[model samples]
Target: MFLTNVLNESDCQPIKKSYDQWYTFMDKNVEFWLPDSELHTKNHCARVLLLALLIGHQKGLSHEEKDTLGMAAAFHDSRRLNDGVDKGHGIRAAEYYKDFCREHELPYDVQTYYITSYHDQDDSFGLSEITNSPVVRERGVLLYKIFKDADALDRFRLGPNALNVNMLRTEEAHRLVDFAKDLLQKSNETNS
Candidate 1:
């Protein structure tokens, strides 16, 4: 996939650096994540990053936008370390990003704030309400949409036997159902 290729590319230094830092952080704090009994460790954050990259590539986002999306995806779930009950993970993530920017000597901007805040929004929050807000519906908002859809796609991989049907109630979740079914079929054929 082009998204996979883009992720693999070494030229995107900022995205690569943030991803490395986040992965290292996650490795040291894996126990903080919500438990899922499934065989996969259920690193929703990593999956969300991958999904965001895929969606960004598929949507033909500009290079700068892709990097911003990637950074947002990498840090969006960092607040999960504290049990994720607090409704301000986005703000927390933004604070982390501020630290990151200072350490890396990177430029700070409103896009970073928008990306972090929107990415951390509760999934149950209605898209219509989000879209109705000017700040929430700007170009930066597209990054969150891509991440949201991609995260939904990964969750859909849990088949009917493994997941509650109610999990796929959202429009994006329902859309991913078909894609997940196809991927499952392909995997089965390969295994057989």
Candidate 2:
């Protein structure tokens, strides 16, 4: 009931028809969480979805994959609350996703779980080790990578003045990083 009023069964009927029956159930409860001020917001999630869609399209993902990625982007930070405790938001979000899957009688794959659970971990989460695992390498690590990168891009957009160089890890992600740095530099120069 999280997305209860925001998005309904009709809005997700197409997704349900094309993918799995559980999509409708997932969509209904996906947006239930309230984000904290310091963390990302619905606006941030939207921006990340847009960016992820663009990147995914450029990467030539199928329509189904794009839809899945878009859904993930929307629900990535769905567990954040305004109290400033982001400790287990990803895990909480995954739990929500699992519940939705269970309610609709869908297959809950491990990759899907990790994709949602670690969307925000960044390099600090030691994802590289897991990603390097033969199993993950064989799957689609790129999907998760792009999702994280797109989310980071929007984070920089939300506070261009506060982003540091250390936040960037890939050349593709650096494009947004440089853009934010340039904006901040221009703002400082204008003030001076």
TM-score leader: 2
Pairs with steric clashes in candidate 2:
36-81, 36-82
Candidate 1 vs. true structure, TM-score: 0.56
Predicted candidate 2 versus true structure: per-residue lDDT over 1-192, tens digit per residue = 222222233423333333232234334556656644444655455545655555665566777566666667656777775434366777777777778678978655555566677775655573774475565434347777767777766555446554554564445555555543443344334435
Model 2: lowest-lDDT 10 consecutive positions: 1-10
Q: What's the TM-score of every candidate structure? A: 0.56, 0.63
Candidate 2, position 61, lDDT = 72
| Tens digit per residue, CA lDDT, model 1, 1-192 | 112333354433335544455445545533323345231232445555554554565567777776676566656656554543456766777777777777778776556566666654555463444566665436755665665565556554455554443643344444455554544454344435
> How many pairs of residues in model 1 come into backbone collision?
0
